[model samples]
Target: MIRVLIADDQSLVRAGFRVLIDSEDDMVVVAEAGDGATAAELTGGTRPDVVLMDIQMPGTDGLEGIRRITADPDLAAVRILILTTFDDDAYAVAGISAGASGFLLKTTAPAQLLHGIRVVAGGEELLAPGLTRRLIARLTTPTPPAVDDTTFADLTAREREVVTLVAEGLSNDEITKRLFISLATAKTHVSRALGKLGARDRAQLVTLAYRHGLVRPD
Candidate 1:
């Protein structure tokens, strides 16, 4: 079973999430917390496979909670998914930078929210399409003239294309259909890019791609 922890300041939100999550036979709610610190504490105790975290809380915010949980060696295996009511993607970028596995809006459909939890728990990246571009845009800045123009020179031509699609939040299967390549080939390209960029997972790969100006926001 995929053990989960619901961390939100609002009791109603937590209760609602619990009901939705527990309804899945493959998942279960191990605990709940009102703040980041408590989330970390319960995480250490419960060691849930995934954490559904809220960005805003009374004392400790979601980003800091993410940082705290990630920094602990004992809790190193925990995966966190940031769920927020706010659309400001700066927090989303910060959360990802702080080691979150994914970001989603609280307004997301119940089905999609459940899918995101499963995605993160399964060690895959989950990014809302709308949030992906804006969040990446926040990470981008003016490129210096002195900077290397061939930012993706290390990646092969096909890998470059694959990474861009990944930054756009396309899954491997979607990439396969788009590129007309086998699913295995698509997965290979993404895996190689992750190794070359020294990214822990696809979430970090998205950030790194944007940092190097790999994908331009529309």
Candidate 2:
């Protein structure tokens, strides 16, 4: 089962998420916290696979909690999915930079939210395509005149292609169809690229791709 921890200041929000998450056959809400500090504490105790974190908690906030959790080597397997009402593009960028696996609006559909939890638990970043572009654009400054070719030197041509597509916000299945490759091949390429690049997750890969000029703002 995919264990989840809900961290939101509002009790009603936490209860609602618990109900929805508990309804899933493959998932469960192992614990809930009303603040970032407590959320961090419960995470260690519950060892949840995914954390549904709200950005604006009473104290310690979601960003700080994410930083704390991601920094712990013992919690390396934990994936944080930031769910909040705030649409400030900067939050999305900050969340990713702090090692969040995904960021979703609280207004997102229930079905999509569930899917996002699964996606992050399966070790993939879950930013929507449009959001991905906006977030990356906000975080990426213009590349220097002298580009660092060696940044991606380790990736093969096909691996580089896969990374670029991922930076473009294509899922593995989408990449398979677009590139006329098998699903397994696409997944393998992505996995290999992540390993070679030493990317903590796809969010970091997206940052690298943009910073290295693999993908440009549109």
Candidate 3:
């Protein structure tokens, strides 16, 4: 089963999330915290596969908690999905830079929330398409200098192609069709590219690509 931790200041919110997650046969909530600091503590102790973290908490806030958890080498395997009611672009950037896997508006449906948890846990990335486009646009507003080739020196030719396709927002299935590769091959390439670039998820990779001039807004 996929082990999950719910971190939010509101007790009702945690209870609601727990009910939805527990209903899934393939997932379970292993712990819950009302603040980011406690969430970090629970993550270290529970070693949950995924953490649903609220952005606004009484203490240590979500972004700081994300930074702390990700900085720990032993707890690095835990994937953090930021749960927020706000849709501010700067907040999104902050969370992504702090190593959050993805951001989801709290108004999202229960099914979408569950799917996001599974996707992040499976080492895949999840971003709401509209929000994703806005995020890319925000990052590309002031074009940065050209990326040095050395930035991608570690990637093989195939891996570079995969990263380029990912920057174009192609899903694994679409990538497979375009590249004439098997599903598993596409997934492998995506994973390899992420590791080489030190990206936590597709959202981060896309931002990096835009910042490095790997992709551009139309």
RMSD of each: 2.9, 1.9, 1.7
Worst 10 residues of 3 by lDDT: 84-93
Better of 2 and 3 by TM-score: 3
Candidate 1 lDDT over 38-98, as tens digits, reads 9988999999999999988889987888989988878867889998655557778898988
CA error at residue 196 for candidate 3, angstroms: 2.4
Model 3 CA RMSD to the hidden true structure, in angstroms: 1.7
Per-residue alpha-carbon lDDT of candidate 2 for residues 134-160, written as tens digits (9 for 90 to 100): 776676676522345799899999999
Candidate 2 least-lDDT 10 residues: 139-148
Candidate 3 residue pairs that clash: none
Reference-based lDDT, residue 168, model 3: 85
Separate clash counts for every candidate: 0, 0, 0
Q: Candidate 1 at residue 24, lDDT?
A: 96
Q: Give Cα distance to truth, residue 192, candidate 2, Å.
A: 1.8
| Candidate 1 global CA lDDT score | 0.84
Q: State in Å the error of residue 119, model 1.
A: 2.4
